[model samples]
Target: MKIGLYFGTFNPIHIGHLIIANHLAEYSDLDQVWMVVTPHNPHKQKHTLLDDYQRLHMVHLATEEYGKIKPSDIEFKLPQPNYTVNTLVHLKEKFPANEFALIMGEDNINSLHKWKNYEYIIENHDVYVYPRLKSGNIDPQFVNHSKIHWVDAPVIELSSTFIRESIKNKKNIIPMLPAKVWEYVEHNLFYRK
Candidate 1:
């Protein structure tokens, strides 16, 4: 089976995340899209993140009804400051029969060279990139890679950081997240300042 590994902090799962996953599953050749819940992304700041388990649970709640969209806790057991190449290697070893691919945004493409063993990842695994609103530039090296494919999905302006801030200010996030997820966030006092 071919799976797309969608890695992110998902401090709280939102509608935009779901939309992208659904889009990839429905329109792309991927059979499944796993939302790999990262404990801490080496590239991102830690202070703004929620607890890894809580974020994972939110992903579970948001994607519970969709069989193709799975919530993964693969990174929780891995060492801190997760690296994509290491996660990919571990997943391949664990699921030998499954073909794992990388799912990322065009914005990430710009910084591909900075990631650990990024060249190896590009050469070995398939990459499915979604367009980001402000990510106008793409790395030439990424463009030259044979395994990379660009996917077109609606570029929603919503972001987890914005949603977190909104929740802190008691702003309505009904439209930003799934109904069940929103309810869970409210009940759990997520993003409360």
Candidate 2:
């Protein structure tokens, strides 16, 4: 099986994320897309994040309806300050029969070179990139790399940060999140600081 790993904080999984993951699962050569919830991203601030399991639950609620997209807590058990290369290596060992790939946005591709052991990641796995409105220069070395696959998925401008702030400000942001996720968030009074 060919699995595409889509890593995110998923502070609260929303419609835009679903669209991109589902699109990749349905349109790309990848057999399934795993929504790998990161426990803590080195690049992101830790204080703003919801608890790891809480975020994972939101991902579960968001992706439960899609057969091709499933939630994963693979990173939860892994050592923190999580690195993509390490996860890939661990996954390859655990699922020896499957071919693992990465699903990311254009913006992530732009910063790929700065990631730890990025060269190994590029050499060993295929990267499926979805469209993003953010513009930045991609590393020249990856410009025409065969390992990277540009997927013409829809350009979604929505973001989790926006949703969080909207909720905090008492704005109705229900439409941005999956129904179950919204219900969970609302019931828990999340982000309503």
Candidate 3:
């Protein structure tokens, strides 16, 4: 089976994240999309992150109804400061029968070279990149890579940071996230001080 690994912290999984996963499963050759819940992303700031288990639970709540979309806690058991290369290596070893591909935004692609062992990832795994609003053209270096696949997905200007701020201010996030996930956030007071 071919799977697309959509890696993120998912402090709270939003509609945008679901939309992309659904689109990938429906339109692409991928049979499923696993939302790889990272404990800590090497490239991102640590202070803004929510507890790993809480974030993973939120992803679970958001994707519960969709069989094709699964919440993965693979990184939770891995080493600290989660790196995509290491995660991919581990996944390849464990799920040898499953063909794994990387799913991410074009904005991240611009900075891909800075990631740990990025060249190995590009050479070994296929990458499905969705466009981010205001993201400029792809870098020439990345374009030369045969494993890159660009996807046309709706650009929703929602970020976990923005959602966290809204929750902190007692603002409505119903439109931005799934109802079940929104309820989870509210009931748990996830981002509230």
lDDT of each: 0.89, 0.91, 0.88
Q: Which should have the higher lDDT, number 2 or number 3?
A: 2
Q: In model 3, which runs have C-alpha deviations exceeding 4 angstroms?
A: 41-48
Q: Report the C-alpha lDDT of model 3 over 86-156, residue by residue, as the tens digit.
A: 99989999999999999999888998989999999998999999888877878898886789998887776
Residue 99 lDDT, candidate 1, scale 0-100: 93
TM-score, candidate 2, is 0.95
Q: Model 2 lDDT vs. the true structure?
A: 0.91
Flag regions of model 2 displaced more than 4 Å. Answer: 41-45
Q: Best by TM-score, which number?
A: 2
- Show the lowest summed lDDT stretch of 10 residues, model 3: 40-49
What is the total number of backbone clashes in candidate 2?
0
Give the higher-TM-score candidate: 1 or 3.
1
Error of 2 at 104 (Å): 1.0
In candidate 2, how many Å is residue 34 off?
0.3
Task: Put down candidate 2 lDDT per residue, 97-139, tens digits, no spaces.
Answer: 9999999999888788889999899999999989788858777
TM-score preference between candidates 2 and 3, better one: 2
What are the root-mean-square deviations of the candidates from the true structure over C-alphas? Answer: 2.0, 1.7, 2.1
Stretches of model 1 off by over 4 angstroms after superposition: 41-47
TM-score of each: 0.94, 0.95, 0.93
Task: For model 3, state the Cα shift of residue 170 in Å.
Answer: 1.9
Q: How do the candidates rank by TM-score, highest first? A: 2, 1, 3
The TM-score of candidate 3 is: 0.93
